[model samples]
Target: MNIHLRLLLLAGAAIFFGYTLYYIRKKQLDLYHSIRWFVLSALILAMALFPELLTVLAHVAGIEIPSNLVFLIMIVYLMLTCLSLSASVSRQHARIRTLVQEAALMEKRICELERRIKASEENDDDIVAREAYKDKSR
Candidate 1:
């Protein structure tokens, strides 16, 4: 491994690992989501420490270039991550829809109850006036 490449990988891994920890601590990122980034940073550190591993993996995978393999792995990871995010968003959409429906139903029930109460009060007032008028006439 060239000294420059090793240094770059080490720095990148350190930065990524630190940012992941910071976000998790601040509650800005969920632990579940951060786990992937942590693993990625660890892999980067491993590659920096042992660049030979990449060559071996490339040979085993029948790839001509190790760098291409790394890029391929990154693309695959990103695609899978995107799929996971899409599913999560879909689930939240469903939950929001359910909550909105429930709220609308609750509002409708409240309005109906209020209307019924108002009608009942009006009927009581009318009955009271009729009774008072009859007593006066008698």
Candidate 2:
């Protein structure tokens, strides 16, 4: 890689690393999710510092172009990230459905209790009125 490009990659990797740490510290990014980002930035820093490493990796992987290897790695990383996110979304969806069902059940129980309370109050009023009527008749 050219000197300018390497320097750019180095700066980008450093910035990414810093941002990841910042987010983690702020609690915006959890350790589990930030791990991949840390690995990515580290890889970029490594490739920038030692351009020959990419060539060696590409050769070992039977890739003619080092850039192509980088592209492949990025693609695989994105695919895995998407898969993980999809799984997380699926779990959240299931949890939300369960929560909605439980909330509905609780609401139904509350309404039933309210109805019973109203009925009990009305029955007490009738008994009081009947006793007052008998006392007045006496």
Candidate 3:
């Protein structure tokens, strides 16, 4: 890689590392989720520090273009990240469905109890009225 590209990559990696740490400290990102980002930043730093590593890896993998190899790695990383996010979203959806169902059931139960209490109160009022009527007749 060119000197300028290396420097840029180093700066970008450092910034990403700092931002990842900040997010973790602020509780904006889950620790588990941040792990991948940390690893990615570290990988970027390593690549920036040692551009020859990519060349060697590309040659070993039979890849002609080092830049294309970098792109391939990035594409794989993105796909994995997407898969992780999709799984998380699906899990959240299932949890939300369960919570909603539980809430609906609780609400139904509450309404049923409220109706029973109201009926009981009405019966008590009727008994009081009957007692008063008897006393007046006497």
Highest TM-score, which number? 3
lDDT of each: 0.90, 0.90, 0.90
lDDT per residue (tens digit) for residues 53-103 in model 1? 988998999998777776777788779989999999999999999999999
Worst 10-residue lDDT window for candidate 3 reads: 65-74
Measured by C-alpha RMSD in angstroms, how accurate is candidate 2?
Answer: 2.0
Rank by TM-score, descending? 3, 2, 1
lDDT of 1 at 111: 100
Give the lDDT of residue 49 in candidate 3.
Answer: 89
Please give each candidate's TM-score: 0.83, 0.84, 0.87
Error of 3 at 111 (Å): 0.8
Which stretches in model 1 have alpha-carbon errors above 4 Å? 128-138
lDDT of 2 by residue, 33-78 (tens): 8998999899888888998988899999999978777678778978
Candidate 3 to native Cα RMSD, angstroms: 1.8
lDDT of 2: 0.90
Model 1 clashes, total count: 0
State in Å the error of residue 3, model 2.
2.6
What lDDT does model 3 reach?
0.90
Q: Where does model 2 exceed 4 Å of error?
A: none
